[model samples]
Structure formats: C-alpha cells, structure tokens
Target: MIVTADLAMSLDGYIAGTGVSPDNPGGDGAEPLFEWIHNLASWRERQGMTGGEENRDSELMREWFDATGAVVMGRMMFDTGEEFWGDNPPFRTPVFVLTHRPRPTLVKEGGTTYTFVTDGIHSALEQAKAVAGGRNVDIAGGASTVRQYLAAGLVDEMQLHVVPALLGDGLRLFDGPGLGPRRLEPVRVVDTPLAAHLTYRFAT
Candidate 1:
C-alpha cells in the first residue's frame, strides 16, 4: 500500500497562514488555499452537506477518498478539526493521531475512530498500516505532520492542490532543514480554474 499525503497549498508554499489555533484552525488568509474544494460535490457529501459543483475537482476528491483506508495525522490537526467535524467525521476509517499526551481511543460516528499515538510517527504509521488492509494509508495533515513523514522518507506519493493566492507569511510546507534536497517525479497535473492539482512520487 502506498503512503500518501494530500494538502491544499498557497502559491507562496504555505499550507496554513500564521496564527493557527483551535479557534482559527486554517489561520489568517488561508481561505484561498481551500476555497477550491469547499464547494465540490465530493467534499460536501463527506461533510454531510448537499448541493455542490460536480466537476474535475469533485471527481479527484472522490478518487482519493475511495483509495484511502486509514489515516495518520498530528495532534494539532485533530484538536482543531474535532469541533468542526462534529459527530460524523469525514474519514470513514481508522485514524492514528500523533501526540505526546495520552488519550483514550475516541470513537465517532461514520466509522471514524481517533486512536491517539503518543510514541512517534513511526509507531502511528505502523498501527495505521496494520489496519489498512492493503489499502493506501494517508498522511492526513496540518503541514508539520506531513513534513515529519517526508523527512523520514515514509511518504511514497504526495498530491498538492496549488492555489493561486499567495500567503506572505505562514506555515510553509517545505520549510525547516530536515528535508534537504530530493527529486520528485511528476506523476500528473490537472489544471483547473481554482487550483492546479499536482501529483508527484519521490524519485528513487
């Protein structure tokens, strides 16, 4: 099973704008990054909402959701998304959360269960893979989580929805030192009015 991470990023390389908190999860000026997918039929369906545009973006979203069996995400992502997700989370699979604090397993509706992993990224991935049943394991993230997996060479593929807007200062996806220099082979590119869907596989 391939380990993949997907994120909507700004033209300036920021996945999230500055001042990210539980109160303001995506942070300031981050709306442009995700505005593309918010109204997609696939996304709306997952959120239990109705009536959204059925287009290439929605189709791509459906494909990704269908391919993923389990997910691993950072604690911050979980905390910030918990309230917004309500009882029925979009992920209808097991989700292993990487966090230092130990918390009991949280079972939500729609087959989504949050299993807090205090050990580390490796431990969280291991557990996610074990339960994935050969389906792809997704690194569902908030920038930092995706960076950790990429640094460790755990991500097999990455899909970046590059939005046109730019965020001058925020959480850059490729920031920090651990990543160094690496070659990424382009798998595909689907350009749309809202964003450009870029898929890449790490070159071996």
Candidate 2:
C-alpha cells in the first residue's frame, strides 16, 4: 500500500493561517485555502450535508475518499477538528493519531475510530498499514504531521490543492529543514476556477 498526503495550501505555501487554536482552528484568512471543496458534492456528502456542486473537484474528492482505507493525523489536528466533526467523522475507515499524551481509543460513528499513537510517526503508520488491508494510507494533516512523514521519506505521493489566496504568515506545508532538495515527479494537474489540483510522486 502506498502512503499519501493531501493538503489545501495557499499560494504562499501556508496550509494554515496564524493564531491557530481549537477556538480558531483554520486560523485567520485560511478560508480561501479550502473554499474550493466546501461546496463540492462529494465533500458535502461526507460531512452529512446536502446539495453541492457536482464537478471535477467533487469527482476528485470522491476518488480520494474511496482510495483511502485508513488515515494518520497529528494530535493538534484531532483536537481542533473533534468538535466540528461531531459523531460521524468523514473518515469511514480507521484513523491513527500521533500524539505524545496517551488516550484511550475513541470510536465514532460511521466506522471511524481514533487510535491514539504515543510512540511516534513510524508506529502510527505501522498500525494504520496493518488495518488498511492493502488500501492507501492517507496522511490527513495540519502541516506538521505531513512534514514529519515527508522528512522521514514515508510519503510515496502528495496531492496539493493549491489555492490562489496568500497567507503572509502561518503554518507552511514545506517549512523547516530536512525536506529538500528532493525531486518530485509530476503525476497530474487539474485546474479549476477555485484551485489547481497538483499531484506528485517522490522521485526515486
């Protein structure tokens, strides 16, 4: 199974804006980054909402959701998104959360269960792969989590939904050290009015 990551990033490379907290999860000026999928039919269906545009974006969303059998994310992402996700999370498969603090397994509706992994990224990925049953393991991130995987060379592919807006200061997807200068082979590009869907595979 391949390990993949999907993120909606701003033109300036920020995945999230500044002043991010549980109260202000997406942070300031981050709305533009995800405005593309907000009204997609596939995205709305996963959130238990109804009536959204059926277009190329929606099709891509459906493809990703169907391909992902399990998910891995950081603790901060879990904490911030827990309240908003409610009982039935969008991930119908299992999810392993990377965190320092230990917590009991949290089972939510719609086949999503949060298994907290305190050990590290490797252990979390191992657990996720074990349950993935050959399907892809998606790195569902808040920037930091994706960075860790990329640094460790654990990610096989990455799909970036590049939005047009720019966040002057915030969490960047490729910030910090130890990420480059690695080569990325372009796999696909789907340009839309809201964002440009760019997919790449790590060059060996």
Candidate 3:
C-alpha cells in the first residue's frame, strides 16, 4: 500500500502560532488555515455530506480524499481539548493515532474510530497498511509522525496546503532532522484565494 503525508502550513511555514496557549490556540485558530479544505465538495460529501466545492483547490482536495484509504494521526490531534472539530468529526475512515497514553477504542457514529498507538509509528503504519489494502495509507497531520515516516522512507506521496498566513511559530512541520534527500515532484497544483494545494509524489 502507498503511504502519503498531508499537512497545512502558513506562508512562513508555521503550523501554529508562537505560544501553544488556550486562548490564542493554534495559529489563527487553525480553523482559518484549513477553511479551504473544509469548503471542498469532496470534503463535505465524504465528510459532512453538504457544501459546494467549485474551485481548483477543492478539486485537488477531493482527489486526495478519493485516493486515501486508512489515515494516521498524532496524540495532539486525538485530544478534544485544543482542536474542536465541532460535534461531528469529518473523517469517515479508520484513523490510528500515535501516543503512549492509552484510550478506549473510539467508534464514531460517522464511521471514524480513534485507535491509540502506543507501540509507535512503525506499529501504527503496519496496522494502517493492513487496513488500507491497495488503496493508500495516509498520514493525517502532526510534524512528528510525518518526520518519522520520512526518515523511514515510508512516504510515497505528500500534499502541502500552503495557506497565506503567518503564525510566527507553533509547530514546525519540517523542523526535525532531514532524512537525506527525498525528491517530490508536483503532480497537481491548485491556486485559490484561501490556500494553494500542491500534491507531489516521492521520488528518491
């Protein structure tokens, strides 16, 4: 199965604002950073079942959703504290989260279940791959998980959502050690008023 990583970053490359506080929260509340994705038709159709996607970015977003099978996330994403994903979640596939803290196996009514992976990213990837079959395993977000996959050379594709915002600092997605040189060729580019969607395939 193919392993793909996807994330959204500011123009200055920051994922969240300077301080990881509660009031300020993630860079620009983090919601504005991903409003572009939330507005996509595929995102609504697959995630919420309502919304109009009529731009290039939405088109690419739909393509990514269609290409994905299983998804993986980090502890920070599983928390109900920092990120508020409203009453209903947007993901419909099985999602595995990496963390040392154990939690109950989440089985959402909308078809999403949060499984904790204390064993590590390797274990999570193995499980994700088995569940993904031949479609593709997707790395949802969080810098650490992506870095681990990159270092292991397990990522086959990457999609970056470059939003026009500056968070100064928060979590740098590319801050960790560089794993040699992995070539990423752009497969698709979508420009919109909100964000630019860039999809690339790993070429090493």
- Candidate 2, lDDT over the whole model: 0.93
Inter-residue clash pairs, candidate 2: none
Task: Point out where model 3 deviates above 4 Å.
Answer: 21-25, 28-32, 46-49, 80-83
Q: Write down the lDDT of every candidate, Cα atoms only.
A: 0.93, 0.93, 0.75
TM-score of each: 0.98, 0.98, 0.85
Per-residue C-alpha lDDT of model 3 across residues 1-204, encoded as one tens digit per residue? 688987888887776655554445454456656666766777777655676767777777766776777889888656633245544566666789999899888777566677888998889988888877577889876677788888888888888889987666577877888677777887888777888878889887
State in Å the error of residue 176, model 2: 0.7
Which residue segments of model 1 deviate by more than 4 Å?
Answer: none
- Cα lDDT tens digits, model 1, 63-128, are 999999999999999999899889999999999999999999999999999999998999999999
Instruction: Return the lDDT, model 2, position 134.
Output: 91
